[model samples]
Target: MNSEGDLVHGRWLDAVGRDGVQQAVGLLDALSEAHTIRRLELPVHTMLPVVLRQLLLPVMIDALGLPRTRQEWGERFHRGRFSEDERDRLAHYLGPRYGDRFRLFDPQRPFAQVAGLEALNGETKTAAQLVPSVASGNNVPLFSALSEADELLLMPGEAALWLLHVHCWDTASIKTGAVGDPQAKNGKTTGNPTGPLGQLGVVVPTGETLYETLLLNTPIWADGLEPQDRPQWAWDERPAGLGCMPAAQPVWSERSATGLLDLLTFQARRIRLIACETEQGTRVHRAIVSAGDRLAQTPETEPHTAWQHTAKPKKGQPHRRPRRHTSGRAAWQGLGTLLAMTLPVESDGPYTSLLLRQIADLQRGGVLSGRYRLGVETSGLEYGTQSAVVENAIGDDLPLPLRALLAQDDGLREVLLECVDQADQVARALDGLNNDLRRAAGGDPLPRDKGSRPSARFLHGLDATMRRLLAGLRTVDEDDEELLERAQLAWEQCVQMAADREAESLLAAAPPRAVVGRTVKSGDKEFVYRSGKAVGVFRTRLASILTRVAEERSAKGEEAAAA
Candidate 1:
């Protein structure tokens, strides 16, 4: 970081003895970017965001100062750059000792680690604890083949990548509890909350380059930003335990972020890296993980997450919290929640992350081009019981046309949203079709979740088609009846094919008894439960669900005639 606290990305971490690509792996967020919506990927971890927000963004905002009016924030964003004055302020903060300060092996001051932190534990913890994915200690891997007894060997690069992962998504488990922490019970700590990103479906705005991505993610401060505490690495003196020499671990406390710096690198835990020389290379064989800072009352300020109103809020409790990512659920399935306009329309609504709002502001100001396509990437870890087990790691992306994204009340947004609703309806219809098929075969219908396999398959099969449909929005100027009709036809055909395929597969797998069919008599009425009977009923429902789009169009036409 420069003297003014701006994160100097280039050559900043070269002191770590890695090349650009190697450094990028350690620094950049886990999900990588490409030219277009070519592919989707998982995030390795989150590190750059912490450094940029803590050391750079706060100072940069203050240099730019507060906005004169409501319109100014968007205006500056439209311009999309730092001013000459802002650049000068950053230049003034540079110093010569940055090289030595960034050293990982610095005897007095190491980067993102306390020098003598190993003394607190008096014994080294397993190396596996640094990486969230590693199955060790109490991380009982129900889904993994490796047992907890198997040890892990980490290279310097691997160690660096997962080190950041632990800080951001560390699970709640037994901790050292440190000497000063009041929450420590019997010299051991439990009930420590997971890292800030633990429950959040992390949302990040992607651009062509790092500069563009960083600027796009930065939300202009309403009242000029003020520089508070610098990032821990840039501090004048290193204090291990919240400023006490003897106490080298933070007390178990939760409070609001003091400033951008405090919140970004919130330090969910205090860590010390034990690097040693080995034949292979510098290996991080052992380390210590202890409780650090905790995130409390922060749904509004955290820019990287979506927020939803709790369905059942207690009388005196807050109603909103960071939205969670569903395991095995596609991003396109919940497109409505990612949009900003959906919040005001419903009582228990989910508003989008703050970054999405910033993008909309830029579009409204007429600074952004409609030709540009936006890639909204979402990533998060799904923790199991007590937030200890890493059940699922979710990462997905949606490439939305700028014109469609900026429209809420009318235009392309309505067309896209309407199509999504129809797709969902079709999926549910498929689920019912499968249940009926089973019932006709003389077997009781399965549960909604189990019977919905076909529905899930049908929806997942359309993922590529949906992406193409969204990308195709560029062909239309705005809301066009013909365009929406054409899109609806495409969706209907996809749903029809998927349902028929699943139905045939089920029938082919049936036994001889089921093929013969069954009948039941209830009073005077006789009912048939057979493949033929189920097929007839399914066709009727499918036809009705598919034709609703046309029916709605016809009704709207009649309403226009009445007017």
Candidate 2:
């Protein structure tokens, strides 16, 4: 089928066809659909046509046990609107084999009362009407949909999928518009969303082999599900705060059929099975990855603002601590810290997860690192409260020597991305320094240094060094070598500071100098007392060494300034 003829439902890929539609339908007849209730949360940039033509439509057809007809498939999976006769026919057809296997749970359904089917107002009050509340949780439509099923494939909303994929499960709100409101007068005049919609959640099965279960059983299915070679999908370690990217958030198209068709045909691609392999005659796996510009990935990040906790002043009251302003950067850091601590740590696999897939692309492009750890210092944790309804279980502490890169320029995402790409070497270099610090400190140093002096020292020095280097590097001129000289001098000063700090630590342990005075040798003069030669040598050498270092740095600074 041509991409132009693809259809979508609930922002999910459905079916694609035109001339080859019948051929695709025939292909479905051969594959037996494992009776699985699979739900999917796809991205806005998901390639609908390919996903439909390659993965989903076949699964749906087989799962429903529908006849191999393009029209029937279209009516159910593609169009999603069915006539009374069609519904009756479908029910009748599947009745013998699967009695009442399919049903919809409407949250708006009225409760059955003792007074027969008749009601006082003859109206069905929605779940919201039954229970009114300002909270998103309270407003959610709570109804039993899959309670009876012991095993069901659960897919989340787009946000939830990204969260799980990235291994970051920060609680957040999803705004969905009001549905079927009689008071809505015009198309755009509908009131704000009813409440915050939450991502679909599933109980994490417990076992020693938990990860294996997750990869195979997760609802996020692709074509060619063959178990081999340690299951292609592997967990990729991403830094904190990359989960909720606003730029690549999925947006479902609300266009007319033709417009949507154009969108599908023009801006879509998918993963196709190329081959399968067995390594060492034991592990087996399918190769389903594609190569091209068509597989370009979209960035995902959590969109959240930093909150400022301020204390209000009152008349005749003691002054309160100032509120901390939360910025976007801080929010991201928090999420990153959470994921770093929580997610599994692994290296090799088939890369089945969407998050893992994206991470691979990012790593290849040098946008993401393969290793990350939590910070030992945090601003968002509450410790010790034996109670119900606990929030933020992980105390707010991060691994010290934090590895975060913020934009030197104003908050422009493009510039920030470029900065990150260019700073890969710098990041690696600093990572080495952090490792050194970690080894020296034994664990995260932030906990021991309650005053954060070491962190402050390292960060300030790093900032100055980077800024100087960048300034010098950015300076462009044929003959002007002044900025470069300045950069070199700045780097030398940084090295000098480190050396001096080390010297100071070593000197602190030295035996205290004795203030002993020696009597001048005697022959004639009787009583001239002088300080010991050892004391004088020690003072003079130390002073000379420090003086030389200072003079050299001063001279270099002056030369650069003059130039």
Candidate 3:
């Protein structure tokens, strides 16, 4: 802060670690320009920890100054001009509000811990209990290397990080009922979400820089707090308030987030850190964790998620809820739900996440240029049976050009999605071909269709071509029919070449038995499963699926011209 006490500044790519500005800046810089971050050598999962993102709205509000109306919001970014004072405020919120520390056991106000849990003599749980990676309660460490870490002792700094992680993502088993919490029945709370972020398939919009990234995620146009559904509540920071978010008392309750400020900084758990003296210094040895305030993340208030809409819902009025990410699915494979103006009937009628839709709005409104490529980052956890285990964490970044996501270009979008559909259909046919050849050889079908490695490989092969077409769509002007033709033709050619290579590999790997063929009962009818016959069948299916998509696109274009 300067002499006037009104300034702060930090970028996502900062080289040095500055206190209160942003943590992990140097680490992020080291891993800069990475197109994907799937597995870390460590056990931690998820992209940005909740603790870092919690201060997002406050910084955006203070420094970036959101325009009240949605239209103005788009225009403001389009004309990225600001006064010096505005820049100062931006600097202020980019980090902590002057003087706030990230310490876990701060004497004045400990980081994220409820004010009086220490005085209340809250029952303490192991420091490991605060870690999501550790197998606490009855959660058996079936897989993840994250499950077997040093759980015995935690330095206060490391303990604070885990403390926040527990509050944000602790599992659903059972929680210790702090002595003062009235909501705890028999000194326990159960069945709450593993954590708020755990429940949400978080969708983040990224740009070349952090400025564009944060603004894209912030939906200035929508009102998150609707009185009818979710009502807003206040948060008190007074030490006497004994609540996770510092209320009159700690209570497990549900409420609506007033805006971005509260939504990001949601008090998901009541946590207290126990500090003990170690030979080195103060180390956190134990903790108390209880259920805290509950805030539902939806397309309306929470922008970073996909939603599924129901028109004639069975119970309440027609509504939408956050859509979960499917494991083993690529972001581009299900791209329609993220960019299409029209929702696929099969996936329900919800629009894309409010963030994406808003981005589309900005694109069409000239807030973003046609060629400005943006990275769409989607992160979600695939949980095991009964939501007890984390099967896998999914993170995929898809680069999409602004022109490809324009809201008004619905016709072009329909064709682009159809192109995606064409590839999907053919890939599945290849999977069938894999099994048919195996069956012909008198071999039992491969588990999970393992024989269809070709199909998976084929899809991976198409990804580069798909990204090119998506980016190349920027060249298609309303009057330039030639550019559009070339783009479509390019994709068709790429798919054919890629499919042929995959088919060649599959056929070459076949044994003599598969070549000779055998008759097998497929469904109800008896069918010959010769390698030659299986290849022909799949090729025929692929041709038909692609032909059908091409014809549909032409027919739609004709219909559009006629209209």
Candidate 4:
């Protein structure tokens, strides 16, 4: 009922019923004239408070045993067997709780001045009164009569007993070496003592006596308390009833402490299912409840059946609902999955989400658009970057076998050839433009028609041809240094050519064209030329021609170098 299905309400009801029964029994026993006994049935849980009292009461009574009263033990002091020193020491140690019945005597007397003084005093003085007065006056008779051994032997037991008594006093004084008696004045002392005796005055004997009592009674008391009929106090003489109490076990309260945790886990799964069902617009609470009951009944054996129960749609359902496609948004989900895969094991949600968003944007913008769609798009980019990194990791002067492997392995070769070919195409295109511009500026004739302009198709074809040649070189198995050198040079030239062509295009389009003539200025310096338009046209045409020538030169150079 308290979310854990425990019968807490039932427990409370039982406790109330038990208390009523106990009160009724008490009233009936009191009113009965004849000797009468009644047995009542009380459930252990309901009777627990009473049981605790029954358990502790005997222990308290047994603990207060045998001295019967503190006065009885004090009266024993007047027997005259103990010397005056012994009497004084005992009184000092035990304090006024025992009263002043005992007294110390002078050592010289050797015997009592009056034999058994109570007998001498006759009716006037009790044994308690006469002995303490006789014993109190001097140190000599006390020290003379008792040997050190006898004194020491008498001490340990009495010390232990006194400690137990002090332990029972809740308000026992703790102040050391104060003169006035503790029991005489509400267990408080006069003043704190500066001396060692003052320090001793504060020393409570409780713990030591408690230890002795526990040692003496533990085994016997433990056995006696084990029987259900025995009072719990039977174990009290064994260190304050500790031995009688049951050892603590794992409890329901401990299990309930983690109740919220278990509930949250169940709720999380339930919420997920609820979200899915609501999204699909299913209304079947009875079915959900029935499935849950079934799950609870055979949780370990029919897990899949329970799952199916939740998944099953209601009867007479429509064949299909209208589907809203969010493929674009779903694509972002794929990107998220990809980014999550690449992330370090320790990476948390925010970093992963941020990276996924960036990747998703890149994919949608066509920046990363290609055959490698979904998760693979991000993966491909990662692979390409990593491959380049691996290649560069191997230095320029790599071993011959490694170089051959790099040049011939289909994957490695493709990567390298693509890089090389791109460089070559760029260089040739730029170089051809720079050369044409120089020629036109030196008064060379320039074609005036659009036919003289570089063809887009031609430039594209040149790029395609270079790509294939580089791809072929990547397939080559032989490791010729000269071939490698030619490849490198070709790649460098291609990059330089591309730059020159771009520069030529910019120069031709710069302002003050007439004053500049057909000449392309390098910096502040300008060379003379014919027409700016003509030079632009001528340079573009030559660049296309030169690109083809550079490719052919690269091929021939590669073949010759290989040979």
Candidate 5:
């Protein structure tokens, strides 16, 4: 009836071609027999191919008639007239030798005779003969049948529709090239070299075109059919590690349309949405009825009309108003209380004392029990002071002891002086002990009674005694000038001897300069005081004293000269 119908019919023929015609007929016959014709109101454009392959062909061959072979149609039908110009163009483009390709299918011969069969007259044919008869030998007949059918069925108005269907169906098969070989000139032979059939002049069809056509013609059918599901495609040139965010879901509410719109606008800016549960047993209908009735019963008023219409306050009576101060004060008081509780307790001197106090408080308050004696033997002061000192120095307020030592205060100075003296004495004692042991280990130069080797306990006791002595000395006050001076002098002498011994030891050990450097601070300022600079100051003073003596000598000489 329309171009769409022609397109549908053409596609059906193309789908059936020759091989599928029998199957195509059977499906259509079954539908026809079922009397469900109304349901078959599919667009002819979309239905034709599917009906031909899936319903028409089989029933037609079994119930109606088998398709004719090309040779049976004779030379008149197969050999069509062409212009001289067309022949010349074909010869020029395909080459003169390509004429041989056209000789394969000779439509002049009778197909029934070629197959060694008589024309059908309601007689049954054996499958063996039938199969061999349609074998085609050097020339296939199916492609010619499809081409002929396509020409017969397609009208000028139907050309576009048929092309669209064919294009869509052809795309479904992903066919590779031209439908027919250019070298073939004879109308009798038909084969597509690059069509879906992978041979020249062969037709290929898929059901997609039929489906689309049916949908276009019969829109009502779409109501029952599930919409086709298609995955969205996107090109992401993002780096390998990237990913896309998921789409957000809608949140529904029973608020007024304006209120809902406002909420949606707010939610668009927020990262997450929260759902509030409605009251239990509050039916939506009941809520709507209540709201509508309430609105109807209420009188319309301007803004603040309720306040304006209220009874006037009694004269001379204190006008009662909502108190805003209580809540604000309560909030502020809470904040102050939090700050007070969180502020660190300020404690000076040893943290051990503060810790002990806290422990005692806890025990008395029943927060701690069971004969607990939580001793914190800290070597630093309490937290606040430490925090302040470290923050001032290095953004970390250290404890009092560490701050004192790091800053090299008077206390640290006294301790360091004490350590130096103690270290020197210990070194001297160790040297003496080593020498004695060495002498004993070797045959003594002075004769001595042989006995068991000296007990290691003696050396251990010596070390312990030295440490205790140093510890006591380290606690000594800086005001003990006499003791400090003596210790300092002795330390200097010991240091000189130790340096000499270290040099000799290095030579004896054959230690590298690198080892020596690692063992000592090489910078001049590091040990300038210990390097006899203080001694040099003394020498300079002595020289100054000598100069005074020389001046006195010269004065006496001048007096003698005057006499």
Candidate 6:
């Protein structure tokens, strides 16, 4: 292991008690065992591997209107419109060893019944029955039943979804660790194939990373494969085939793509329960199979991709270079304006625009074309053009009531409200700084204790508070001079107070002599002590914010003063 990994492992070892350490080791062993079993299931020669191919084969077989019997499949393979190579491949796949693997086409294992939307009305099977179980105990039954060519498929409309969820999660887990780290060696940062943390029903609660992983796995239609190529009727014509709906495509259309994401997001919120028979009685417990379904539902749960915004890419799209947009901010601003017209009072507008803009920029940078590159800050002018527009518009100083009324009509009300709230929060945070430091020091300040000592809690709280305040200022409305002045003052005071506190804390925490490093223990948690760098890093952020705030104050102040 690398130094970083060793350090992290050591920390984990120390943090996880004796029992926890055993459990952690056992989990890793189980995961490794599962991976080994999965590898043996891979098919000999195909672009799509065994499990993925198997998952989609039943639907493909039914869609192609192939016969259930191996004899008929061989006859069709010889007679149908297939290339010589395709014919040979089909023949080999249908041969004794691999033939039974095609569950829908295997005549021996007949389905109990056909199920679809119509069947949903009368179907009584629980979600747990339809989807594969994540519980180790249930794996044996799931593998046995699902592996059978004739076993029941719950809902054809939903089967594609579950297949996608299962396949992508498996792929992601194999590449990354259990948590699905995007920065992991083989992990994909962009695209619809996120690591499988959700498939195992583990929520990391670390920003939107896990949710992004799920969206990354959404099965999109290949550019080479169009909807017209394989018409819906092709699948519908087959008799005894359960599902009538075509497989869900992420790039079908804007409406279709959005709808799929919405449905996936909804399913992500549903929890599935597995029933186990014990000696005492029947026991029902939660399983990871439904983990993706039970994702925490929220507006942010939906995944965003550049492909969703533009038409489906043509074949060879990933190999081509994308054209750049120098004045691309206008495109994003136009989208923002349209959204603002129908904006919700509580909804995030600018941030939404920001994400959209970021994706658009990524698209322009050939991100869709598979051109990997680093991104530098796009919005990096001493003062932004948007702020200038707001300043030019802020001509007259109106009454407080009139200002409030106008603010209601202003398209940027949501952004402005957030700014006001942040300023208020930071101001209040500054007022309570001493108490926070005291709390970190066990709720009692020593007589010789200086207010400058930085504790983990105090540093983290200040860091968070300052970031919020700065985010609000990013899109601060210069039109409202009164509000602008108050916000500027708050920004200045916030930076100054934070710097003073950090300096005092650093000096107070200093030992008699400087050493290479030291460790401090608080309760059971151990913290590595670095010499005053925390305070220094905190100051850098404050300095950056203050610089921007000062520029706005100077330019907008003179304009407002003249008005």
Residue ranges of candidate 6 with Cα displaced over 4 Å: 1-171, 174-459, 463-478, 514-563
Give all candidates' CA lDDT scores: 0.61, 0.25, 0.60, 0.25, 0.23, 0.29
Q: Candidate 4, which ten residues in sequence have the lowest lDDT sum? A: 286-295
In candidate 2, clashing pairs total 26
Provide the lDDT at 261 for model 1: 50
TM-score (all chains, Cα) for each model = 0.80, 0.21, 0.77, 0.17, 0.14, 0.27
Writing each residue's lDDT as its tens digit, candidate 6 over 1-563 gives 11111111111111122132322211112111221221111111111121222222322332333233334333432332333554344444343323333222112321111112111122223333333332122222423434322324232223323333343232211111112222223321112222122221111101112112111122322232223222221322323232223222111111121222222212211112233444533333222221121122222322221111223346744211211212212122122221222223343232222223332333333332212111111111111232211011000100111111122355333433443344334333432443333334334433433443233334444455444443444344436566656765675666456646655654475453322334557999975444344334444544454555556667888999999
Ranking, lDDT, top scorer first:
1, 3, 6, 4, 2, 5
lDDT-superior candidate, 1 or 3: 1
Question: What ranges in model 2 sit over 4 Å off?
Answer: 1-563
Ranking by TM-score: 1, 3, 6, 2, 4, 5
lDDT of 5 by residue, 453-486 (tens): 2222223333333333333443344456676555
lDDT of 2: 0.25
Candidate achieving higher lDDT, 3 or 4: 3
Superposed on all Cα atoms, the candidates' RMSDs to the truth, in angstroms, are 6.5, 24.5, 7.6, 42.0, 45.2, 23.4
Worst 10 residues of 6 by lDDT: 390-399
Cα error, residue 89 of model 4, in Å, equals 84
* Lowest lDDT block of 10, candidate 5: 286-295
lDDT of 6: 0.29
Is 1 or 2 the stronger prediction by lDDT?
Answer: 1
Per-residue lDDT of model 1, residues 1-563, tens digit only:
22211223322322111122333321211111211112222235344443344334544443345454436755654454555554555444323434344345456655455666643346677677776666677776666555556656666555544555666778887776454556666656777788877868788776544435556666666654434434445444323434422212344356556555556656677677777776765667777777766766674878888888766678976777788778787787777777754454336778887878767667776756666667777777788787876777787777766666575676677767777877788777666666666666777777755534677787888788888887777456664768767776776667667777877876677666765677777899987777766767777776677785446556889999999
Residue 283's lDDT within candidate 2 is 12
- TM-score between model 5 and native: 0.14
lDDT of 6 at 16: 24
Residue 514 error for model 3, in Å? 2.0
